[model samples]
Target: MTNATQAQLSRTAEFIAGAKATVPLIIGAIPFGIIFGTLAEPSGLSTAGALAMSLFVFAGSSQFIALGLLSAGAALPVIIATTFVVNLRHMLYAANLVPKVRHLPQKWRALMAFGLTDETFAAVSNRYLLQENIQNAHWFYLGSFLAMYGNWVLCTALGVGLGELFPDMTEWGLDFAMSVTFIGMVIPHLKSKPMWGAVIVAGAMAIATVTMPHKLGLIVAAVCGIAVGLSLQLLLKAQAASEAQSR
Candidate 1:
């Protein structure tokens, strides 16, 4: 076999490896998609609109925020701003992929950028950054993205179609699934005292600002978390420096 053929096979294997790593993330999306479908009716969005959201936006958190604001009769601006803020994390995700993806064509980069959701971003970024001989990184992302996209669409259809069958899931505590999912995601990052402190401060700010219009409370929480996290991280660094100088 030619060297080029061998290299192509190797890249394809790497891509598949990246894709398989996204299974857990896809599993986690099912219940949330169901909830979104169930909530779409209550949020005043038609089944069609709800399904369209899953197809187009595809971001679970942003979709939930959009629904909450729509239910609250928020203007388009507020909904758009909140969605942007919630998804700003994508910028960081994209940056992490830069070292691995920078060599790809600009068009491929754009397509990958569109597919870069939280779960895929986490899985693909970790693999590409850490793994070697990643010939088919794009295929791995495609696998993860397609898996998630399918789950979102099917579950949403189920939710919207059966939404009326099960009313008031809030009383059943099902509404907390989203919060639980987020907590699960966030807890892993709180490996330091300052990280914990930032989470607490952000939680407090979010609750305190809950009355804000158009679900701005979430934005407040995110900002507070970033500010506190960065601030405490800097303080710890400075303290370490001071102690070294004193010694």
Candidate 2:
């Protein structure tokens, strides 16, 4: 086969591999999507609106926040602010991936930016770390991104269709499963002091601000965690530089 043909095959394989590898992690999101679908209607969203959220907003945490605020009759600006705050972490994720993907054109970047989610990031980072020599890494990214996105949309539709059967789906406590999934994801990666510090600070702030109006504590805690983590990282880098110069 020609070298060009071989490269094309490699890209295709990587994309498929990425999608397949993330299938298990995507399972973790099923319950969350279902819970969102179940909660959406009772939270004052129509079935179409729920599907629209899954299609457009696409961020699980933000969608949940939107639902909660809507259920409680929050104003539009309040709902927008809370959801936006919950999704601020996406900016960090995007920034981290920029060095790897900056050479791509604007269209690819835009698609990638839209597809970057917590689950996809977990899948992509884990795969990229292991497959350092792989060609067309973004193909894998797209694979995982599409798989997770497809699962979310399908599961959401399922949840909405079945939502009527359970009038009090909120009482079912299914959303807790997502929390468990998140904790599982975080626990395995607390190997560094910076990570531990961020987790502790974020956790404490979250608890302390638990009763704040309109779930504003979620925003405050996120900002606190990012700030603490960033500050620690910078300090560590400076200290390392100073030690090197002294030597």
Q: Pick the candidate with the highest lDDT.
A: 2
In the range 100-217, model 1's lDDT, one tens digit per residue, is 8788888988878878887787667556776786656777887777777788899899888778898765356555655555566666667797889888998999889989965667
After superposition, which runs of candidate 1 have C-alpha atoms over 4 Å from their true positions? 2-8, 132-135, 183-247
Which 10-residue window of candidate 1 scores lowest in summed lDDT? 169-178
The TM-scores, one per candidate, come to: 0.74, 0.85
Residues 26-73, model 2: lDDT tens digits: 777888898888888888999999999999988888898898889899
- Candidate maximizing TM-score: 2
Supply candidate 2's per-residue lDDT for 2.
100
Which pairs of residues collide in model 2? none
Candidate 2 Cα errors over 4 Å, as ranges: 127-135, 213-216, 230-247
